[model samples]
Target: MDVAEGPSSSSVVSEQTIEAGHTLLLKMPTGDVRPHKIEKDTTVNLGKFGSFHANHLIGQPYGLTYDIVDKSLKVVPPRPIQEVEDTEATNELINDGEFVQPLTSEEIEELKKQGLPADEIVKRQIEQHANYQLKTEYSKEKYKKRKVAKYSKGFSTVIPALYNVCEYWFNKDATRLRDIRPDALSQILNLASIRPGGRYLCVDDASGIVVTGILQRLAGEGRLITICDIESPPAYPCMVQMNFPKEHTAVISSLNWATADEDYTPIVASSEPPTGKFKSEGQKSRLNKRKVASDMLMRHREELFAGEFDGLVIASQYDPWSILERLYPYLGGSASIVVHSPQVQILSDLHAKLRDLPGYLGPSLTEGFLRRYQVLPGRTHPTMNTSGTGGFILHAIKVYDDPNASSVMAHRQKAKKAKLEAEANANAAPATSSAEPERPVSDETLAETTQPIESSDAAMES
Candidate 1:
């Protein structure tokens, strides 16, 4: 096993430790998923399934599947069980569910009110079923899955990957995310050439979906400057849910585009001391937070004016061309620019504008077409419902804008002319006599030459 390199100061949850405040993906036995923020000193209630102390999850490795066990319903690894036998005898026992042991709603409610263990309740229900012994091993497995979905008190902790979060948001509300599907987001990352150690300028108006997606590629190793035009920073609901470490989150610098050209200083402390001792602790805490926020703002401003960015990504409601026209100047040579929009007309106009622009290469518009398939034995086909459009994307690379455009073009023409002339000279010149003796060194050649030490020393000795 390999040892951990070191610890990071950011509050983001690492793979090894699920700390408090970290958002996790809790998957139910029914294949349903939901996001749960790990609050300190509180119980995470999963409704009918059960509840576990938030502290119970802290310090646990991510992606570990835990089963709710015992009276208090503590989380623990599931106990190993024997695999089901798939014999012909068991297959012959399959029964249709037309009529079975019918239990009234009140009876089921009474069983639940008794607080009986889920396994015990399931066993009792199976025993009461009229066709209990008639189920094939496969049928029994299917029955168990249904019961587990209804009564199991267990969940698996999943690392909230950017892709997963995007997928979750797509499921939750595609419209809010600008209709950016997971596959579409993947294409955006690819087209933008997002990677570690890159400096990116982003217009993340989609609640930090683009920001978090970029961070996944950066992997806590790059700079992200998010430009917004608002009084308060845009609420990155999705990014906050990811709980990126303060250090990694530190990489993301937010700036108001209105003041991006202006310089400002951070307020270190209040000029006037507390007027009275009546100020509560909450007020003092709020003051300190403001100071910290001011300092962060100053830092982000410093970085924004520092240098050109490696890439520009926009997933905003603003006109893509307008945003790019203003920001394209800040992109370094060969920098990629990617714009995502649900409508085709926006990209179509942007494509025309980019073509007219001088310092862009291959400004093309592309669409991400995705279709999922359901694969199972004897039941494999394209899923019935698929997103009609993942959205249109525009990609282009920045190029050096030559100050002397005419001069540069003239120079290229002259060089080509020189090359052709030289080739003509080589071909038209009289063939060199291969048998011609080499030319003897003339006075000009001898004047430029330095005799070897061996010959000079012999001459001097003589």
Candidate 2:
């Protein structure tokens, strides 16, 4: 949390413990003032100022302001969650630009004639082949948004680079995943200690596109793979065979205790709600009309993922916070790499949690891009924007942790003899103390952080 004292208002913030529920902000820096009806799991952007998790600040001592540096917020001034009128209308207006009905009947028939439901088909394509989906999803929404003003421009035009990025996301094709050279993959893979015969599991929402790409890239070195999903793939079975031999591919019907042979190809499926909004509280989580509690999900997860995996990857676009909490434990022994969008808050939060694990790309992973793309820290909500929709990738490797008596003593020796060295010499003081907190100025930095959107308006003009 920080204090931004301006001509009109002054503020302070207090950070509550992790998982403390929503974040609350009091405007006017006064008593119990809240923006009308705070939205749940919602983002409160203070414009040119800051934004924060509306839920996390609940129960905090009153009077707080939060900063949305990058995409995550640091609660400087904190207060309990205030009841606000639901902002559903505003949110829908923002998201839909103009709300359109779900897919129409004729469109649904066309999609079914080709394969499964239109939405499911697009979802699966996104997973199996993101590039294909990116090029195609525009057609899916064309009809629904026909009456809406503007929005006619394709979300992503048929730029060859766009397709290039999508194809590149999948396994083992260096030419496809542009910008990331072979050397980078080798370094990351080497650091991960991945070798032939390593058991790998991936849970990505982008059509298993990235996970499958990893598998193909590491093929023939004796790698074992597994996948967990809540939705079925449309062309997945065939896609797998076409990519890798059927002998290597194994799709498990259950994410529970049901097991596959020790050695198998990568598993695949969607993490969508099979039924209901909220289920029983279980290790796993699902949101729908029917909510299952967290416990049931956990029981299912333990039953399925009790075994060892050399590496784990998360690619779900929704609920990254919940997903990481559920999956991090499984990678307790080995390093778990979380790849997500910058807009995803958990990625940054995860980086913060792994404070001890030195030298992660997490700290500066997107620092360059953020410093380049997302400028102002207040107004940039580009396509990959963070006003509750954009996301970013975060990587953390879980390694063994055992209290070695000697090591603990060795490291703590400095703090143990804890001398109050001097009045003004605290190493714990933040580096930006006297220096003005530098805001990004470069167009590249601004571009990197605004959102991961392809050129639309710029191209249309050209």
Candidate 3:
């Protein structure tokens, strides 16, 4: 069987519409998003709202809203949210009861069975509502929105970019991502200075949320070496969910912490040809797999040992200081180092530790707080609920640690102290020495006495 290759450079650049096997997000009318992989001739099930054939979405541009009509999808313009104005209507006489809507469950189900459109069903319910008219304009709008959220059979296509993936995972299970919000992840990328063609070292224990962000920013360029656990392979469920193309994922290389040590030797693949045929096809396949794994491991080990990474980004369960101690040497001079942790205390401790360490500068501990807002016209305000704390980030820069420079600075400080001491001693002796006739010092003697000190100071300064 022939295997398919990844998109070419031009295609990758120009491709915008959804394609078969592309993973995309579906944002339902209820403001819920679901990840879906497009497959031809398959049906995508959206519970309560309905299901639609996946082919209808294929080749379609993203951000288009589709309404299910007779089990088929049709592009529909999004509902416009009108600016609600103040009105005299009040809820004083309005009764809040289950019977406020005259439409019964049986009737609604019957309407659904009859294949009535969601909009039509909602309109009928509104007409039958007992207190909808008695409420204010804002309340009426809110009521309609609630009904729409429940009955609307429409969804919009969303691109599974880094932001979208982070948001989806965060909303679904924030703990799974170590509570790293989208804003926090963005900050990490910025602090680490992640860019194309730059090599980065990452220790992501947040199920690949950090790794995914790094790779997405790399955009199919540069290298990302992630450290994983010794026992198991790196688990990047979040990255896998993004469904990146082969070229984009090709830059990622991973090795276990145990193998990252200098003393650990990776098994290299033999260059010699095979001497005999395999006993069976399965045996040959297994042997080939082993060879491939061995070669990849060796290559990754070499890439890591050959240091000078552009940046280091870590979101791990291990002690941040320990990780920094082990991987600090790999970072290039002036390389950005960013460590993310769910607990601020840990990062705060790390921040203080980095301050006293050589070669680390401007260590800062920061926590990101993200609050969403409802941007509706004439009703703009912060959302009722917001995420508490994403996480804390400890950022610092790694510089060249020159032993000679440090020694020279120390000598200069020592010489300056000695000079101050000698001046003090001379000032005390001057009063006693003034009583006797002091012999005039010759120019050559004075120059010789001070020349050594001046030369030494200049050498230390230089």
Candidate 4:
């Protein structure tokens, strides 16, 4: 992040060591404005205006514009560029590291509200790296002359939590998680059948892991019933209380009955104080058996045996059949939303449970392993094989409201219809004019149409 720059303040087109993404926000003497995205090994073009060596841009000053001179950007000797690092641009920025997300809900909604297709909105966010900020710095300038030149203008705001979701999901390593669009989210939720006003639950045994993205998605939709064990005073990530919309939140405490107001369900737990390590398969099995027993022993765990949610997010060690053993029955066919991650134990548990269920929608959980969702860092590489983009996410929903539920089939039909509608928009497209001229058919077409059928007599003659 060290940026060294111009020999002196008056120097025009002086070089600075510009890190990729660290923009040179500046006003130049000649009034040529540019926000240069630092690139490695590539020379930039300013046209008859001028160009500069990518390395030279590293140490440029903020609020100072570099004028293009005689078709090339001016260069100053190796002036030490002061390294600039914004925590907002580092730890907090979505897609700066593992995975990526660039667009915001408000931004996508604005595009949709403005009549953009979900795909187009997503494409735009990806291509232009657009986010929730409405006014581009270019848009903020008083004069139109500089608006295009000084394109940094936009509706700027703090880095958002959903941006993280986009990062993890897309793993593009962009300065923004560019592809997390409303339409895609709408598809995912609708596909999961997370109805408005219906309760959504997330078991946050993973702490500040991948579940944050899932919870954020649910919270964005509407009513949510978040389930988590209070290993600490407040189990859920503080990001929710701080970032999620308040009216959409509903706090449900399901803890020990010995404690007051224990109206609850034991949605999460660990067998051996949830240690982070298990050296061998035997050790893993022993701990798992104890985990299963503990998870099962939780007071009236069977009360949650039936499926009861529009959606459910469970993270940490997937107990395979063990976790679902207590939860699937409660799904009672109403479980339209379910998501999990690489917690192998949970996948194993769910895989077994689905085998018993009438209609389980999943790839073969019996064989192979979970695929790591890949991600790209917005910045350059620290080294190869290490990615900011890569992880796992498993999703499902139980449609059976009854053990003998024939209605599950009906539910699926409706769900398919809803997905089709959401995905394949049925709105009218621009029409072709009746007066438009048409091209004539070719002679080959006429010959093909004119070819005679062979009767028995014609065959004999031939």
lDDT (Cα, tens digit) per residue for candidate 1, span 102-196 = 56667766887777666667788887777766666656766765775676678887667777788888777887788888998998898888899
lDDT tens per residue, model 3, 277-325: 6777777777888788888787788889899999999898899889988
When summed lDDT is taken over every stretch of 10 residues in candidate 3, the lowest stretch is: 428-437
Which is the leading candidate under lDDT? Answer: 3
Ranking by lDDT: 3, 1, 4, 2
Question: Least lDDT summed over 10 consecutive residues: which range in candidate 4?
Answer: 150-159
RMSD for each of the candidates: 14.8, 26.8, 12.4, 25.8
Give the per-residue lDDT digits (tens) of candidate 4, residues 336-357: 5344443345556555556455
RMSD of 2: 26.8
Off by over 4 Å in 2: 1-165, 168-195, 218-242, 250-304, 342-346, 356-364, 367-391, 403-462
Residue 48 in candidate 3 has what lDDT? 81
Give the whole-model CA lDDT for all candidates, comma-separated. Answer: 0.74, 0.39, 0.82, 0.42
For model 3, name the residue pairs that clash: none
Candidate number that wins on TM-score, 2 or 3: 3
Residues 106-197 of candidate 2 have per-residue lDDT tens digits of: 65446545535233644533344323223223333332233221111011111112122233333233223322232333333444455555
- Segments in model 3 whose C-alpha atoms lie over 4 Å from true places: 1-14, 95-99, 230-232, 267-289, 403-462
Give the number of the best model, judged by TM-score: 3
Please list the residue runs of candidate 1 whose C-alpha ends up more than 4 Å from where it truly belongs after superposition. 1-14, 70-101, 115-144, 261-307, 371-389, 401-462
lDDT of 4 at 259: 22
